[model samples]
Target chain A: MSDPILRLEGVHKSFGPAHIIRGVDLEVRRGERHAVIGPNGAGKSTLFHLCSGEFAPSSGRILLDGQEIGGMKPAEVNCRGLARSFQITNIFPGISVFENLRLAVMRKHGLQFTFWRRVSRLDNVTQEVEGLIERLRLGHRAHTLASQLSYSEQRSLEIGMTLASDPKVILLDEPMAGMSQEETEYTVGLIREIAEDRTLLIVEHDMSVVFSLADRISVLVYGEMIATGTPKEIRENPQVKEAYLGEEVAA
Target chain B: MKLRPFLILLAVMVLLAIPWLVSSSMLNAAIQMLIAALFAMAFSLLCGQAGMLSFGHAAYFGLGAFATVHAMNAFNGEGLLPTPLLPLAGAAVGLVSGVVAGYFSTKRTGVYFAMITLALAELLHALAPHLKGTFGGEAGISSFRMPAWGFGFGTAIEVYYLTLFWVLLAIGLLYLLMLTPLGRLALGLRENQRRLRFLGYNVHALGTLIFAISAMFSGLAGALQSLNIEAANYAELETHVSTVVLLNSFIGGVRVFLGPAIGAALMTFFGHVTSDVTRVWLLYQGIIFVLVMMFLPRGIVGELVERFSGKRPAGEGIRLSEMLPRLAGIAVAALGGVVLIELLQRVMSRDYRALAAGGQWPEITMMGLSWQPGSPLTWLVPLSALALGLALVLGVNRRAAARREATA
Candidate 1:
């Protein structure tokens, strides 16, 4: 197989006295939907933070496309084509939905610091943002404030914003944290559609969605990955069953 | 957006015609008003647009004034740079100081950012006089505006026109800036800075740039102030100047594009009126500020814009018929307030005491009437007015609350 799109080599993270990620060696291959599933307090979010450059790993290397990106700032990491969404809805609430997406699209087109031109007159940026709005079904809310959007709609917008950068690797943190069954199914389908030709690293608690979507699953237990395998192999893995999936499978 | 340029043109026309119609004194006041308005707008860009509340904006304003004065003095001797272009010196100095100050200040956010700016301003204010050579001690630097562009700026009217030209151009450029990517990003920075970072924006650097841009305009205002007064003083850098700019911006409505202009004009005119007529002008100014804060928190223009905004959901609006009664009530209340305040001032005044000492009963003159202090009518009339004012204000407020609840 070609080199993995993202590789975490013995990554460890600690906050003062508490060690969160312990020797996390993981590889997310190109064009693969990789899901990290773990119980609460298993440092799943911490691991994502390490990968996304929100916090520097205590020790170890994080390589993105064969480049060391561990200690870089979030903006630098984002500029290198690694985009992420927050577990909490993170968007410019005062700005219109189109503006929120436009900034991202503009950044993708290397217009982050383009101040000479009026943003309203940027036809290409506008066209790209409108396309994104259409794709996310947010055309109706193009001019609405992001704060005024419904929770599910905001989640969808967040996903759309993540894609606006046209990132090589997309990391989604709890894409469906609080959603109805129908909303979840809708988002899962949306995620499937977007993740078609890109590398995806998702951290989700929904077992069914994870099993159905992930080409490979890494089961994290107490800041350590105990098992990583395909859905069938993971289902048959005794350690993952004992550590986490035991109750879900039995149920 | 299409109407914006037309409105700007209209504003320019009105401003240009003012000196022709108004008295020379009023023209002088207008020039100061324009300068203050520009300063306030520069501040609004930081506090209102960028979400950075700076308490020491006068630092840039004062520095600009000094720079302009020095430039005028130095260039006047050389006969190279025109008097009209002296403000560019102020802008340059302002930009340089903004970079120096912003570098240190932008390291922190929120209140810390405010404190750092305040400290920086205070430091300059204290140290400037001691510098002597640069600050000219307490007296400050002074320079004459040289004749330039074949137009001698000898009269107040000419200076007014010069000021009007610079102010309009600055305001126009600033407005255009808001439509630019940098300005839009400043809004985003205010809304969700962390989100911008995730979008690959260096938020702090952008903030510094905004700070510098705001400072440049502020400097221009200061430079104009120096030209108008023919002197730059320590008073320009004082906390009082900062407070004035803050008040003008807030009273006008920081969020609205022209709010600061309206505010600066109102405040400058008010200052002129109070200084001419009343000894207790500051008290009145304080009362006006409090009233504005309590009732018109968004500033005059802000409230008007909100009331008439097309973006407001349909079917909700104020009919003049409904508003006329409120206006009438407010006018009555305002009259009552003025009478009560005037009466109270007369009663407590040192002038009233001097009159009493001279064996004459203290009298108050108001609205074409004079009343002896001992007369029950004097007390009763004002007391009644005060009561009516309170009643009308309460009634209006209750009606407004009811309307809001109904809408909700």
Candidate 2:
């Protein structure tokens, strides 16, 4: 990769005594669908946090499109064309679904800090939010409060919020967690559609979804990347099978 | 939505017509009510809309009042500025101080935020007497609100109109602020601080901005008070004043924009009436606060809004019918309550002029009618009226619920 969109070099994070991520060195090329799979407590979510600037690596460099974003604020990182969704489906629950999307769109257009003009009168923002709502198939529930939406719908809104920023890189932590099979299938399709022109990095548990979606895969285990290859290469890699995939493959 | 502008117009007309309808003293009371209402609304901007509960809001109001007094004095002494624009000085100081205080206080949220505000307010109150130059000692700063722009504010009524003008402008501007992006984000800040941060917003900056805006408005109210009374005292900065504003906001329903205003008007009038009737006015205020907290947790306007939240307006006149029976029940209950309270107070004090001459049977004047304190009939009438009013209230409530069910 001549210039990877996201690069983690010797990244290490520790909470007091316990080292969450020992040293993670990874590179994700532009427009590639990269998925990181790990068992429980492998610090997959923590790595996402570091990459998204939620937490700085204890000692290493995190580069987003060649700029070192390691000690930067999440907002500054976002402004540099990187967006992420939480594993816990973080969103503004009190506001309407349209308003949630509109805030994100406004933030993208450098309007979050503005107090002079009414947000409701911003024609482009309203149009873009409407377009996003239609694209996400959230039109039926556009006026409903974000909290009132079903769990799957909330996740969809989260992803929609991430997309509203129009980042060059997208980091998703467990996008399909706790979703019904139907919902999972729909989200997979949505993610695939969205990932066409963006660098997609996802941390997921669903093996079948991973096999189908990831253009390349990195297997993280015990705070390190044990393997990184294509689905075919990963499926046959002996180390991956012995370390993390054995139980999943058998089940 | 079309009816909203019409309703606003009607409200403005009524406010304008109040001078013609009421006596000058009543108009003075109305001026006080406007200032108190603005104070409450300013508090609500932070407490209700931004999810920031400030306990020492009187700090801003006091600072504003002091600033206005100084401005007025300057206008009189050196002609530095016009009397009409004195509130702007208050607003400027309030905004500056609010930003300073908010910057530190907003670092910690929830209970800590409330505590920081309380501490800041107490510090100002304690220092006021010592800062005799600015605070004017315990007696506070005094100034003459001179006539400006050919509008002679020599009379109380003229001053009232000026106040009305500023209050209307302040309220209108505050309402417009709610439509802005910053205002929307304030609501967002209240709901989910972490989420806002994740969305790339500086949550601290937003909190501080709202704090400053709220303080500015509060200061504006205080400046209006100085203009009205021609005095700015240390009492304005006391914790008691802060607590009263909090009570007014809560009772008005902090969640509703107009809730605090209604609550302020009610508390101001109630305070006046109770003080006129008895010396234990504070006790009466406490009881009302407790009752409101227990039963009408959302306050006067809040409860009404909650009841009507899900109901679409089928017709305008229909709401009046629904409210009439309830209002009647409330009126009766209030009348009964007031009569019983006054009679009991009179009996307990026993310091009435008629009973001062060692008379066993005290001649009590209840609503201009003579009553013998020793007579059983006197006690029975109030007690029976109380019971009757309470029963009617209960019956009316049940009917209202049944009607709601029918409509649903």
Candidate 3:
């Protein structure tokens, strides 16, 4: 199918009196890095939540590989080959970094509800978790509890878990929120490498990372997508310059 | 690591030899301890591993007991459910009830999840008496242990072996289950239920399965109770049954595989020994619970493991010289507190009040000594002990901190 890997058509969400996502529309093609950028309260996170099934859209359709996924349960959305990371670090804090990825990878291996086999003895899963830890540069901290990891390491774990499922589309919600400059740079390179194979939908506040990493950028303003274009096209877009990118990109 | 399995085997052998070493009455108490240990292990699966604090596990345990009793009476313990396999009846009933209750309870999580379990158990307790045929009414159901597999199961020794056999097998299964994928997912459920959803896991379904499995083992424990006593009582469904298992599991350190079992066995043995002498056994149990939560939040076995886990630097280990004084202080404080509680209990008793009507405070004999209740010495002695204990503990803490700083 030639359709975009993830398509959001005229999506709208409202909480009683609050219209958080007001008729937003976007598309993420397969094998490309897509970034969604907007000021605070522009409904960027809400849009991620909508696509991720944290909240059902009040209206409109979300299609993954031309299959309707809007309003589906998170597990159902995930099984359809879409996985996401939270803006706030969401991980199994009580367990080791290796176990967290194993939990993520085990589902793909059809190990859900398996009671007879020991998880430690599942050689493929252990290997996959080890490979993920190495790729995230967290092999040294593999057995440490997720809660004990430094903030940046925890973020890497979150991304590592999201990627473990080998999903067709991956959504990362401001993964670099609390990361240091060096950490962010390392993560930018990491994300770019991972995005080489899978479709990525990321919402990042760091302007330089977004501009440099995204193959296509969607500028959201006031619950609406004002512009969607390549990096060079978005850079020169006058309307985008006025609404969200103001002054920072101009300099 | 190699010593671990050898130790377990040696412990099992010791348990196997208990019938020869202990009196029948002691063996009988050991039977109760085994049953209680099994119950607590079942509970820890849901509470410690899955992180669902169920306030009404007695519902499953009691259901299992009643089911086993009915099975015994129906088959005369000779057919499908022989003396050896009777717990299967309890297991089946427990699993069914667990699935039904877990479906509703797991729909809401945390405090709400706990409330649903409590409500369901309370509902069963309320309705149990009305269901005369099933629950055997107020008097409950009684059954006789029929001979099966050539063992009469007629004496306390026989019953103890029976209970030991089943408890070991059930506990063994539980340990194996913890090593499985489902077992690891239960930890994930406790760690972060929301994250499991995005990881392509049906969190609610997983919770229900775990809850049912826990209830299944609990039912087996109840079955053992019926086999030991040759009866089932509605009294098994009481809230105290639920609370005791919760307390015992927490005390044993639910996170450890055998922690709850050890906690339950230890507490049951203590209860059997002290219930006759002190009416305040439960109060002591409550106090121990509170103290464990405050001072050793990991519970008895949990705290022990943490201390010996070698996670800290070798130099950080408490020296015997430093620990001796602290241990002595704690023992003194405990003895003093027990004496005080016993004295206060006797003083406040209606019998004591009647014995000493109007201005006459009688001397109460305890611990091979007579103490006058109205005397200053009585209050002063225990209070002094408590103060000294507290001071010693605080001093140790301050000293440890200072030593650490000096070393740094």
Candidate 4:
């Protein structure tokens, strides 16, 4: 494939004595949906954090669009067209839903430090914020304080905020966690719709969702990826079956 | 659509007319109130808006005061800037002090953060007395109010008007700042610092910027005070002064925009009235504090606004009927126990022979009981009365609670 959009070369990370990620090597092509799945304690979240620059790797490197991005701060990584959504909806609770999207857009438009001018007077910003709110199906709740929103609505708002940066690569950390079945299906559809034009790196635990949505899957066990393949290939692989799906398949 | 600005203008006009109506003493009081309001607003921005409670805000206030005083002294020989520009010097000094303090204090969070600020203020307090030349020892630095730059009036009213003009300008600027992206980010930081960092914002830098702004306003208030009083004393930097500012802000309600201003005004009025009426005003002040903490945790303005607007409470509200009786009873009992212990200790320490020789207390009769102020029995009576009062309250509270439970 034309040069990978993102490449992780033998990335290693550890917290104190616990070696969480042991030499992870992964790659994603442009416009690809790459899902990373693992058993508990497999360091899936740690890998995503490393990719998003929340934490630096112990060793090895990460590259985005053929440029080295390892060891950069989360903000620097974000400014370079890489956006991340938290596993547990990190949003401004007291402000209106529109304001939350506006913040991300303001940041993207390099207006983070524009203190002298009133934010409400930014016409183009307001228009863009309205459009994003409509696209995220949050039009009804536009003026509602974010803390007042339902859980599923918050997830949609989180995705909307992530999209505001117009990122080339989006890192979603368990976007479906605490979401009801209806919410999950809705989010899964939203993910597919957005993934058409941009690269997506998602860490999910639901195997069925992973199998159905991911273009390619990487299974991590004990901080090490034991399998990387299509759904069929992963299901049929003996090592993968023995390590993960063995009990479910047998039952 | 534009009624708010009209109302604000009307309010400003009324405030400007205050010196025309009120006495000079009250005008002086008003000026002090305006300065206190500025200081309280500065404190609230850090404590309320940013969720960074600082105990060393006096550092900036004192720095600003001293800077203005020294500037005034220098102007007597060679004028560096206009008198109106004195506040700017104070602002500059405040910014530097905030940067220095924030660098060390922002390294920690929560209680450690408060402790570090308190320790820094205490250090400054100690240094103020020792730094004889710069701080003017106990007497403090003073300057003559020479007429400069056309707006010269040899009256307290002119100074009050000038202070009112500055207060309005400073508050307006701070209000505008609260509506900015940086302000919103500071609020977000207060809610979730880690999340803000993860979102690619420099949480520390955001905090430092707000700290600097807070210090700038605090310095402005200090500069105004120096102009009003013609001196800057070590008392301005004391921990007690810092605590008073904190208490004023909290009792005023930190969350509301106009809360600090109202709070400063009320505190100034209370201080003036009580000091004039009673020598034991601090005891009354302590009692007011306990009552406020028990009943009106959000302060007068916060509670008033909530009552009128019917808005959801910012904090959990306790039903007074359930809590008040118990609280009052406990307070009375505690006071009684403390008094009883204190009286017993004093009586044990005193020698009867010495008391008689001193002619200290053959002296007083009240309600058919003759006793000296120095008599152990006289002190014991008050302590016993306090104990009786507490016991009665506790008994009533228990009976009430049991009755309510039974009715339920």
What is the TM-score of each predicted model, taking all chains together?
A: 0.95, 0.91, 0.98, 0.85
Candidate 1: segments with Cα more than 4 A from true spot: B1-5, B350-361, B366-368, B374-377, B396-408
lDDT of 3 by residue, A130-246 (tens): 888999999999889999999899999999999999998999999899999999999998998888888999999988889888989999888999999998999999999988777
lDDT of 1 by residue, B1-408 (tens): 788779878878898899888988888888988998899999999888888889999899999999888888784454326888888989999999998898889888899999999999999998997899999996777778788889888999889988888988998888888888888887887888888888888888888999999999999999999889888998889999889999999999998889988898899989987788876788888888998999999999899899877767655577665467677767777677777677778877887788778888856776689877788887777677667766765787687778878888
**Candidate 2 on B153-196: residue-level lDDT in tens?**
78888888888998999888888888888888888888888777
> What tens digits encode model 4's per-residue C-alpha lDDT throughout B1-408?
377689798989989899888888888888899999989998888888888899989988999999888887884534345666677778788888988888788777789988988999899998888898889998999875666678763679878877888889989988998887887676776776766665667677778888888888898999889888878998999887788788888878887888877788788778877677544556656666676777778887888777756465433234477558767776776667545544444444457446756765444433354556666677777787687767877687687668667766
* Each prediction's number of clashing residue pairs: 0, 0, 0, 1
Residue-level lDDT tens digits of model 4 in A1-251: 54689999999998899899899888887888888887887898888888888899999999998888889988888878788888888888877898788877777666655579887787888899999888788999998989999998998988888888889999988889888998899889989988889999898887778889988888899988898887778888899888988876555
Task: Please give the lDDT score at residue B347 for candidate 3.
Answer: 94
**Candidate 1 lDDT, A120-173, residue by residue in tens:** 898888899999899888999999999999998999899998999988899999
Q: Is candidate 2 or candidate 4 better by DockQ?
A: 2
State residue A120's C-alpha deviation in candidate 1, in Å: 2.2
Q: Ten residues in a row with the worst lDDT in model 3 chain A?
A: A1-10
Which residue pairs in candidate 2 have backbone atoms (N, alpha carbon, C) closer than 3 angstroms, thus clashing? none
Candidate 3 chain B weakest ten by summed lDDT:
B75-84
Q: DockQ for every model, please.
A: 0.73, 0.65, 0.88, 0.58
Q: Point out the worst 10-residue segment of candidate 2 chain A by lDDT.
A: A106-115
Please state the error at residue A90 of candidate 2 in Å.
Answer: 1.8
Superior candidate under DockQ, 1 versus 4:
1
